[model samples]
Target: MKITALETLRTDEFANVLWVRVHTDAGVIGLGETFYGAGAVEAHIHDTLAMRLLGRNPLHIEAIHREMLNLPMAQSSTGVEHRAASAIDIALWDVFGKICGQPVHQMLGGLCRDKQRIYNTCAGYRYVRSNNIKPVSNWNLEGNEGPYEDLVGFMTRADGVAESLLESGISAMKIWPFDPAAQENQGLYISAEQMKKAIEPFEKIRKAVGDRMEIMVEFHSLWNLPAAMQIARALEPYKPTWYEDPIRMNSPQALAEYAASTNVWVCASETLGTRYAYKEYLDRGAAHVVMADLCWTGGLTEGRKIAAMAETYHRPFAPHDCIGPVGFIAAIHASFSQPNTLIQESVRAFYTGWYNELVTTMPVIKDGYVYPMEGPGLGVELLPAVFERTDLTVRRSSL
Candidate 1:
């Protein structure tokens, strides 16, 4: 069947709004979630990409993806363009799966494992319980800021939050304490002492949790090579699971150099999109763990392809998840289909409420493992009325 229409639903969840939607035809429809900043990707999809998607063969996922890539979106056919393409690509795979009467994972090479390993990203409750660190209201995934005197109290709340996550069967956790003081102003430069203080909680979390759980330090591309290297060395003794996004996403040469210099295995590529972009990272051996977000890397269609490519190189992949249920389930389908998956990321905040509101019949996570849903396609059906109730605006981009 030919493509009929593409739709997007943008909702205000977490600090910023995220985009999710489905592509429909007369017979079958596919679901996808776009990975982008607040108002960025939804506008791109609704405005320009949606028009191009109409009347094309929705099953021609690879061809459609390549057509979108030829457009000069963001810069050099990368950023926002890939995000829009990813949404469409994912939906196409969903349609493909439904047409064949199988889950997307089954279509992607079948299941390599019965369940996927997951780590809790919601450490607010856990951190507070175990370390006496109280997190601020709505920890925006961008870290926090307060008076120097408030550091002790914050640590206390954080300890408890960390403990809670571990108690909740989270064997590993991720924290985006880019820097305690630099939260409000991400571009603000800080002294070396301040940086040390920022990572101190992680060191404390390690001491508290010991080997009970793995801790991942998220830098959010906040440091230059020198600063990132310095911080990497400082945290080496603690033996973190990985140092994520130590530097920016540009220049594979620079990324490889920095990764080679540190004992910490550099984890990058949440921003990088598609198997095309992933090739550079793999060719350079820039990362030990390639963090590919199926939502951003062209959904299950391309996500499974990228993961398979990394597997050939003997590198493990960790699918990034910070968006809604669509992205989360899409990542699971892609991860379960690949044998090289390391661990998947999950935001407890998003999954708790927002994800529940979007779909029905999803996988259940128990004891840090996600059991695959035994339904067709992505295995979750979107509630159209819920989509309407959420009150998301589908704005068109000028492009």
Candidate 2:
């Protein structure tokens, strides 16, 4: 069956996350969600890539992915073009799974294990609520409740936060206490005082939980090589899961140098666009673990390829999911299908909070592990009430 229409829907209530609906000549319609820049990604979907998808077989996911990126302006980058293609590819995969009467993870390759382990990225309810991604210093969101509170608490109360996640049966947690310094210093340098302040949480977590919990430090790609190297070397004693995106991902040579400077493994960026970008990081030995955001890295079609490529290099693959609900579920599908996958990222703030407000299916995370998602396609859809919100915006293109 061919695509009859492509439509984008958004609500200011959710702000930055946009949903796409791919209508087929058959009765089924597939759903996809993408995070960041809803307005720009929406325009790219309709004005730039919709024509290429309008009459195509919805099951030709790879070909359609290429067609969407074949335009000279769209090629070889992970910008708006790839983001638009990613959402469409996810929708098409939903269609493919529906056609085969299977869940997306089953369609990918069937589950390799009963469940996958996960790590929580400490973030507040209001984190990434807008298109602008500058790090936030304040944790004072209006809805900071007792059971579900701790946006920036990872820094101030590392011990309490660790205890809380352990209570949920989650054993791994990720935090980025050094980012506010990078933002202030332009990633150029971290003074001794700043370095001491940043290491406080690491010290606290190590003191509180000992080796019972796995801690991952996120640099948010907000440091220069010198500062990143200094931070990386300083944290080697704590033994973080990996120093993630410590510096920018623009150059593999610099990252390789930083990786060589310390024993700590480097987990590279999820902001990269395509497999070629990941290849550069891999071939250069810049990163020990390769990460991809399925939503931004050309969806599951491309995420699967990246996973295989990481396998070829003997590197563990991890899918990034600090985005919307549908993308979070899509990442879990990719995580289960790939044999080399190490773990997946999730935020209790997102999963236990806003994620429920937008979608029907919530991933099963308990005892520090996430079970393979059940049901056909992505196993989730926009809540029907989402469409009725007064702040919604929609645009459509048809064959």
Candidate 3:
């Protein structure tokens, strides 16, 4: 069957727009999630990529992918081009999977493990409250006022939340001190006293949890190298499972320096896209852990390739999940099919009722591990009405 139509659907949820709903003529369609802040990708999807996709065989994913890359659609490669390529790639895979009557993971080489382990990120919301700081722009999930009440409000609620996540059988959680108040301090050289103060919440949690959970410190690329090193040194005693994006992701050499200096595992690459972008980091031994985002790092097609590349370096891969259900499921397919995958990032924000409107099947989280659907393709369907609640528009055009 040939491609019939390509669509770009935008949603108002998270104040974000994800490209969705690729259509083909053989009574099959595929869905994909484009990441946040890549509207140029959506424009390319309409103005450039659509021309190459129309009338092409959906099953020829690699050839279509190669053509898209070489098609001179853009003067440079950035998240926008990658996001456009990723959405189309994911849709093609979904179509191919439907045609083959198998899940995407099976098509990738079958399951490495029946279930994937997930680390919670929603737990990070409390760090803002406990520190008595106002939430910053983009830090609050809802984009509203103060996220939590106060330190006591945060502490009391945080315990119950952790207990609930633990009870749900989640083994690991990621907490970020990503308050807006903290953003101004980011990338600035912080004093040792400030670094110590920044780490107090993690120290307290480690003492309370006592090794029962893995805490991943996310700086959001806020600290300079020296400050990051100092903070890493201070938190070394607590034994965080990983330190995420301590320094900026702009240079492999900078990341390498931090990795070389810290005993804590350095994780990077959520901002990175495609194999070419990941190569420098791998060659330089820049990171101990590679965190690839399915939505941001070229979807499952490129994410799996990146995972393979990371495996050659003997590093663990944790597919990043920070968006909607489509991103989560696509990441799961990649993670399930890769043996070297360390953990998958997730949050209650998506899995709970809030995300239910976006898709039919909730990610199966049992006892800290996620299970890919035995169903076909991505195996999740979004109800048509859900889009109605979202102030999103879908338009498809061909060059």
Best by TM-score: 2
Q: Roughly what TM-score does model 3 have, to 2 decimal places?
A: 0.89
State the C-alpha lDDT per candidate. 0.69, 0.87, 0.72
Q: For candidate 2, lDDT tens digit of each residue in 1-399?
A: 789999999888677788899999997889987888889999999988887789999998878888987888875566888888889889989988888889999999999899899999888777777656667543335666445555668867988999888888888888988987888888899999999999999899889998888988888888989888888888899988898998878999999999999898789779887888999989999989999998888989999999999999999999998889999999999999999999999988889988888888798888999998788888888888787888989899999
TM-score of each: 0.84, 0.97, 0.89
Better of 2 and 3 by lDDT: 2
Model 2, runs deviating above 4 Å: 137-146
Off by over 4 Å in 1: 12-25, 37-40, 74-78, 123-158, 181-192, 394-399
Better of 2 and 3 by TM-score: 2
The window of 10 residues in a row where model 1 has the poorest summed lDDT is 125-134
In model 3, pairs of residues that clash are 116-370, 136-180, 169-367, 169-368, 187-222
Residue 332 miss distance in model 2 (angstroms):
0.2
